[model samples]
Target: MTKIARRTEKLTEALRRAGVRITRQRAALLSVLAEAEDHPEAIELHRRAEAVVPGISLSTVYRSLTELENQGVILRHQFDGTPARFEHTETRHHDHMIDVDTGEVVEFASERIEALQAEIAEALGYEIVHHRFELYVRKKDGL
Candidate 1:
């Protein structure tokens, strides 16, 4: 199966396991979530899903997202001064940089930063369990 199909199936199975009935509208939303490459808010997701299958309510989208999040199949990011956005949990570990002017999210991974965080945690007499790091940035004047 294609990657999108696999992701869609994984999401479907997760919802099923969580006892959510796979309504047609919910299926469309799942497909949209699976194909999403950028973090999108619930309203954006609802709009996309509505394009595929009309009559999907915003409340339905919110409820479905809550169910999926509870199932641990997705991660929600509430960046500063923006609505909550979501991405699937299949992505590898990475930190985010949010553009202050455009609300764009950029993902990056750094071994050096990871090591430094670990060292700091050790010095503090604690082991790193889970963490989230975000940087708010703006474009340079000449860029």
Candidate 2:
């Protein structure tokens, strides 16, 4: 199934669904994003895209990312004070645990936590239409 997805769902197709026009530069940016596992900020994403599409500019990357986000093809997260990072929307839904010391992001999901959040929201006399959870963490000594 994953292999089929990799073969079928190019980022450009996603952009089209979001009403974005496809260009060579845009395709290159999407290619980089499709291969990325970790969240990457604009500069980092541009750097990676450069390898595939020479002469890609920083401004173009920013524009492409913004378009992708607006199209609902990508999701953004800001960890600590760092520049925002982006991930593809089709990936599994989960919360992020950032190792602030290393800037590493670990994705995790918990049914119990989800339930608790819903309960808390209801207790507060509101329902959760949408939410984001991110936990900043540090490694313990002699782990």
Candidate 3:
């Protein structure tokens, strides 16, 4: 199965396990989130979801996001004081770098940074339960 199909299935199963009814509206929103390439705020998601199934309201999108997040099928991040963006959970861990000027997001990973985070947490006497990192950036002077 494709990535989209796999995510759709994950969301469906998670909802079922959580005892949340799988309505067509919820399923449609999950599918959109699953297939999305970049992190999209609620408005962007609502727009796309409406395109997929006409007449769906923004409120429905909000509720579905909240529920999916609670169910652990999605990850939501608020980067550099911007609106919250959502992504389907991925097995591999990564962090986001945001272009402040153009509002673009890029995913990146660094073992050195991960090790530093662990060291900091250990120094603080806290087992890193969970953490997320985001950096605001700008394009260079030239391409």
Top candidate on lDDT is 1
Question: Where in model 3 is the C-alpha error above 4 Å?
Answer: 123-126
* Reference-based lDDT, each prediction: 0.96, 0.82, 0.85
Q: Candidate 1's residue-wise lDDT over 87-133, tens digit each?
A: 99998999999999999999999999999999999999999999999
Model 2 Cα shift for residue 72 (angstroms): 0.3
The per-residue C-alpha lDDT of model 2 at residue 9 equals: 64
Please say which candidate is ahead in lDDT: 1 or 3.
Answer: 1
Instruction: Residues 49-121, candidate 3: write the lDDT tens digits.
Output: 7788877778878877887889887888888778999887875799889999999999999999999999998
* Model 1 residue pairs with clashes: none
- Cα distance off (Å), candidate 3, residue 126: 4.3
> How many clashes does each candidate structure show, in the order listed?
0, 0, 0
In the range 1-143, model 2's lDDT, one tens digit per residue, is 57335622655776677677777777777777877888888999999889888988898888878877886778889887988999878777699999989998999999999999999999999999988899999999999
Off by over 4 Å in 1: none
lDDT of 2: 0.82
For model 1 the TM-score comes to: 0.98
Q: Candidate 3, after superposition: displacement of residue 35 in Å?
A: 0.4
Per-prediction TM-score to the true structure, in the order listed: 0.98, 0.87, 0.88
* Highest-scoring model, TM-score: 1
